[model samples]
Target: MAADDVSVDDKVKRTRDLLSSFYSQDASQISPPSNTTSRFATLDTINTTSFDADQYMNLLVHKSNLEGLLQRHVEMAAEIKNLDTDLQIMKNNIVGMEVNMEQLLDKIMSVQSKSDGVNTLLFEKREHIEKLHRTRNLLRKVQDCKKASEEVMLVIVNKLEDKVSSDSESIQARAEAVMLLKQLDFPVEKLESKLLEKLEQFLEELDLSKDTSSDSANPHESINEGIESDSIPPRPEVPTREFVEAVHAYHVIFPDSEQHLVKLMHDLTTRHFEAAKQQIQEQVSSAKLSNRLRFIWTDVLSIDEVLPEAGLQDFAYEAARDVLKQYVTSLFSYLLHEISDALLQIQKDGIGEEYPLRAALEASKNALIQGSTKVLSDIRYLLDEDLGLVLKLRDMIISWVQEGFQTFFTQLNGQLLLLSGKDVPTDKVSSGLVLVISQLSVFIERDAISRITEEIGSSLLGGSYEYGSSAFYISMRTQRISVLLRKRLTTPNWIKHKEPREVHMFVDLFLQELGAVGSEVKQILPQGLTRRHSRTESNGSTSSSRSNQLRDNRSNTNRARSQLLETHLAKLFKQKMEIFTKIEHTQESVVMTIVKRCLKSLQEFVRLHTFNRSGFQQIQLDMQYLRITLKDNAEDEAAVEFLLDEVIVAAAERCVDPSPLEPAILDRLVQAKLAKTMDQEPVAS
Candidate 1:
């Protein structure tokens, strides 16, 4: 039993050790069941002769069960070891959760601090708002006080202004009275009583005048006549306080005080116009000069070609002299009247200031100044080359223009008098003056043509017809003036932004006249060469045979005459066409230049209007200064003079023929006539 027991115990110990090693777990160092091992060993080693198979089987079963138990214990130990690892991980997670809780608490504390700061700021802002409200209320009160103070100050200032004005007015009145006393020619002490005695006697006469009942006996007649006389020679009232007060009082009483002004203006215009007309009559020489003017047709008649080679210059000088003399006289007279009329109209229309009478005067002066030289030159060119005759004619034209220009400018000065409410009669001259000026250019052209004809060879004068060169010049001058007037009247600035429809009406009338002339030209032109005049043909059909041969010969002679007449007519027609072409070209050039100027003016107007409102007045003042400076420098005057010299002279030069044609055409005819005369002579006389 001891050996078997010991061996079994050792086996059990080993089995226990093996299980521990296999599972790698400590289970109180437990020993495997020794009883089972011992049983097994006893069964195997002991020669148990008596033991049966069943007993041996039982021992084996016991050992197997014991082994299974050891295996189960090892499995349980392994499960416990896994549970320990999970427990360690759970402890680590719990430690991390505790750290997170601390962090959360710190964040909560920080949030609390910010919230407290915001509350403090809100409290301060609310107090500040309350203060602002109080300050606004105070400002309102101050504003009310300021308004009241302003009203009181305004009233006080107004009262002081009125008092000061009254004092000044009184001082002015006293000064005027002292001046009147000083200017008095009569002794004041005796003058009053004597005037009073005369007045009393006049009153007595008035009282006794009621007795007469004749057709001309009116009680108020003498007073009316005195009033009329006063109107005729209206003098400015003395600068008395009474007169000033009356004007002021009248102005105050009638806010619209222009009625009296209108009437006064009308009377003044009438009176001044009459005075100007009288002045013109006294100054102007109404002499009927000889009509020595002749036409010099362009390319149709030439002074040089018609006269001998040596007499070319002399002939030209003579032709020009005769032509210009008649024209200059008429022109000067016409210009004087026209300018006078324009001046009167300016006063009548109350437009002297708007038109600027001084400027108009200057313009007229410049026109004359420029035209005078050219006129003189033309006159010299017309007269014979005797330097003395040429000089004489030149001097005459110059003198006439100078006189006319002076007279015209004088009218402007007189116009200013009319504007001052002195009765003037300027309106009556407008139409007549215009008509005279209108005739000037026509007369000039006609006179030139006629004079040229006289200078040409005798063969050139085929008929009683004469050229209307003077008439052309006058017509052109009239048209130019009309154009300028039309432009001045129609422009926006000219009327000071008040576009007068009447100006348009006037323009329309001018345009209508032009249209009628154009229509007349169209109507009078021949349709075709084949279209024979029925009237001429109708008068030419009846006669005898032998008488008819003589008639035929006469008819042939008449036919030849007709051919010559046709040649003359053709030359005249060509000259007229040339004149028309030259005029058209000149007019186009002038119009283009004028349009450019107009466009520039419009651009300037726009630029001026666009400047800031505050700058507008400054710009105007600057412009005025510039204008004054320019005038002082004589720059604009020089420019206008230059333009007048260049433009008008060039245009006029175009009007007159530089080379004429009638002499050349007539020379060929003369040569032919001479050759025919030589051939017609008998072979042997």
Candidate 2:
């Protein structure tokens, strides 16, 4: 057993030595190991040489082991073969995928090319559609223009046909037709020449008709029989309708022709006015003048009728304006002469019981009013009620009236200067001034101003015309009249002396006028306002007395009620007196204004001129009288007192022979001149 263990150990040692040598072999020469090769060559050697028979017997005993190893190797080989087949299948799939990708790329390129073609087609089609739209729009416009042109031509032809066919058509219709043709851009030169020829023919026909009508009326008389008569027969009326139509047709064809007819009408009206004036001047009768003026105005109206209605009003206004200007111009000299004659009569006759100055002024005023009324009434008759034209004519007539009055006053003033001082009655002159101013005030207020206000107010409210400028013009005329009155009436030449008596006369007149105005106004003042006082009674013992006392109590109650009624009546009276009070106030203001102005002038005159002591005394006395007189008239007491002081001071300043006024006299003057409330103490040195 010991010997067998030693041999086994030796074989194990040899197997370890062999494994180490095999592992230590050079890597360069190394190869896969053979399946049959032994890792331990010593073991192989021992098995082959010493234990070969034993190992062979052991292998025969372990044949199942060798078969198990072979089965594992076979399973591993089968797994490797399956992996190789899967790899081949994977490679084939990759090739197929590459081919599919190429096919998809080819299809995308084709689609892209087709899309390019479509885009180009779309671009070309878009341009074509735009061109078609433009052509369609242009064709529509051309068709519209052609239709409009055809319609215009048709209208022109129709108008021309109507003008040729209708002989009885209105001048306005013919004119409108020609105007329409011109508006349609038709040539009108031939039409104008044709109208002129027709006008000439119509005039010739009118002349023939007139001659025939005259012959038929006066056939027995020779042609020279009426030629010797001083009065010429009335001219036949012109064939206005036919002539107007022809003229209007010409006007439509040649727009400048209207001016020619207007010029003709102007000349004709001028000739008629001149003829009327010459006849009236020769005859110099109011009836003849009025007749001639009426005739001329009627002629003017007829001319207006001949004109086209569209422009009739304007033409008539112009004609009437011109005629009025001519008529007023021609009549101005005659009117002035008549006014001068009337004033001369006043100067020669003196204002007697008749008050010739008042009569003369009334005559002049009447003439002016009549003349204006006549002219305006004619204008109203002739022209349409165009407020603008009416206002314009009214203004012109007002200006003419103002001029006439101005001329009359200017001449009258010159003539009044020719009167000797003795011949000129101071009372008459003062009365004339008051009368004239009052009459003028009433006339202007009633006739001119009220009428103007009514006309302008009506026009403004009715919206017929803008009266702003017209109102301003009328206001200027009113101011002109005021200025004229002040200039002519207030001259110092009319007085002839700067005497205190003469100066005080105006003051007396002013006071008297104010007194009259106040008296007239006071009549309408509230009355019956007497104050009552409480009464103390003595006692009487009687039953009848007691009954009498009861009756007295009832009477007292009735008186109380009557007093209440009087209060209400007084209120009504105040309301009714408002306008009269205003007029009275106005008169007072006018008188006061004149007084102040005259007082100022007198003061200046008194300062410049020397006055004797006697003159001063007279003036002082007169001022004292005036002061007392003004007290009852509600005159401004302070103003009156101030004026008195100024007059006294001026007289003192201009006193020639006085050393100084006596203190007593100065005190007296101051006491009279100062207001009643002023101290009556003597003035200190």
Candidate 3:
């Protein structure tokens, strides 16, 4: 019974708490937990056995103690039920309306599509109407021009006016049309003056009209007289938008304005070009030649966009080619001066030093290579990258620079001759400089020219090629040797009366100079890579073949020979006679020319002096060794042999008693000369 009473009281207390929380407006008040005793006190005071509806209501009303709160709750519950019923009705209506709205939206979309089509048709008609109007206006202007006593082609002006509305060429066409419209009413002289004024401003902007001479004269201003100068506006890559407008204005207002503008621009280009030339006339390598050229052409080609209807781009190309030609010629001149200065310094004090010529020649060669490369690169940048013109300028500019030698090569040789005056006699050591010059010429032609031309590209060189310097130098090689021979084949050389003991000092000097030429050639030319071959034989059969080959000899004496000749008339010589062989530039061909010259000079030198029997045999010994030395180092071995025989014959003719040296003695003397040369190698090292 006690548990039942407690349970009943708990049910009553829960009912009371539910009523309070549901009716409460201040949620914070309900949020705070009431004391435990206060919560159960309502149950403690409630009647236990009365659980009927009326009893529950009376109990709830007594516990709540507020009729308004119970009434508000009952009213709110009734309103919520009514609202739910109405909401169901509203949902059904909304579902129906959504279906109707979808149908209405499709109808709206159809109407919008038709409206868009109508708008497009209207726009097309309007555009057609505008076109017909423009055509009518153009025809009317043409008719009016035809009817006028002093008729002008107003059709062009009207067409330009019509074209101004187009988007692609709108800016330039608008400039022309607007100016042309003004010209029909405005003073022609005033418009011309305005155009001229703008033209002057454009020139000023480009700094083409600046008194570069005055600027150069001022030491302070000269320092700042480059494209980077703050005195001038930044050079526009194209004509300024305003300048183009002014140009078109002038061109439309005055038909002759194109010729006027072209003439003016040509003048400006000339002056600009001249100013740049002045900057580099004193020092080409020092001046900012590439940048200055960029500045000038950038403006010329830019203005050419609208200034002249035609020919200006080609003019720019030709003018630029001319300028580059001058600069390149100047570079050659500068190199010539440097080489001459070095040679002059050497001639003063380099009596015994053989290296000065080689050093000077190689330095000049390398400088020319680097300078020519830079020149071609600058040309490439201007034509290929900046101007977007490659082939025409490449064909023109590259040919100009590359073929400069055609006209200048003679000047070069002439200058070289003048440097070494014919009356002057140099030392034997420096006498070989002519051969070195010949070697340099061959390198430039055979290797440097082709390599540089190919690297820069042959798309411009056409199919044909010419190496004028190489041909010219080779043609004059013998003549140049005559000049050098003044030192070597003197009276003293021909007047020697010594026995045929060994080779003369001239042989060693000649060989040493040829070796130096070879070494210098190796340095300047391209040497991509080299790989040393294995010294070891591939097999024992190769070694056995070599040993088997060594046993065959012509001379039956214990003094063995290299090979037995098939014909007794055939002269048996050493297998190896090549000296100073490197690239194609430095091999037998180079040495052959000098050898021929020396031999020919010797023949003449013999004619100048009479020889006794010993002196004649001495010449024979020298000639025999030189024949063996130079026979294999020639392009035409038979010619060299013929020349060597000519020398021997000349010596025999000059000898008072021309009897042949003994074979054993001649052989022994040649062997001793070879052995002494071998022995000197280690000591020199």
Each model's lDDT comes to 0.37, 0.48, 0.56
Q: Give the winner by lDDT: 1 or 3.
A: 3
* 400-442 per-residue lDDT for model 1 (tens digits): 5445445544653454344433564656344433333334334
- Report how far off residue 528 is in candidate 3 (Å): 14
Q: What is the alpha-carbon lDDT for the whole of candidate 3?
A: 0.56
lDDT of 2 by residue, 1-685 (tens): 9967964675565445444444555433433235533423322443232346566445544543666447534743764576467667767988998999999999999999999999897987889999999999999999999999999788867867578446676555666667777787777656665555555444444431112023222221322465543134334444444555555456546766666666645654555455554554453333333334444455456556655433544555675566455555545555445544554454454446456657766765665555444433333332222334345577675455445444544654454354312367676554454455456446755785445344433332221123343334333433443443344234433223243322334444445444454454355433223221111110111111211221122233354344334434443433221111111123343334344444445556566556565565555555555655554442333444445545655654455432233335534654554443244334421
User: Model 2, residue 195: what's the lDDT?
Assistant: 56
- How does candidate 3 fare on TM-score? 0.32
List pairs with backbone clashes in candidate 2.
none
Expressed as tens digits, the lDDT of each residue in 1-685 for candidate 3 is 9967975675565556554654567533553234565534433332232225565455556666576457646754865676577668888999999999999999999999999999887997889999999999999998887777344445654565455444455344555655665656534454455446556655565544223221232222433556455234334333344554556566666776667777776766776677667755765432245446656666666667666574667776767666666776776676667655654554466456567667767766776566556555544433443433334555566666666644455666676666545456665335555655666668766887676665455323322233233324444555655554555555454445767668778777666665664565356434333232121311111222221222233243222222211111132322322322222333344445555566667678777777776776777777678767764445545445555555665665666555556766877898899888889889999
For all candidates, what are the clash counts? 62, 0, 0
Question: Could you tell which candidate, 2 or 3, scores higher by lDDT?
Answer: 3
Arrange candidates, best lDDT first: 3, 2, 1
**Top-TM-score candidate index:** 3
Report lDDT (Cα) of residue 636, candidate 3: 48
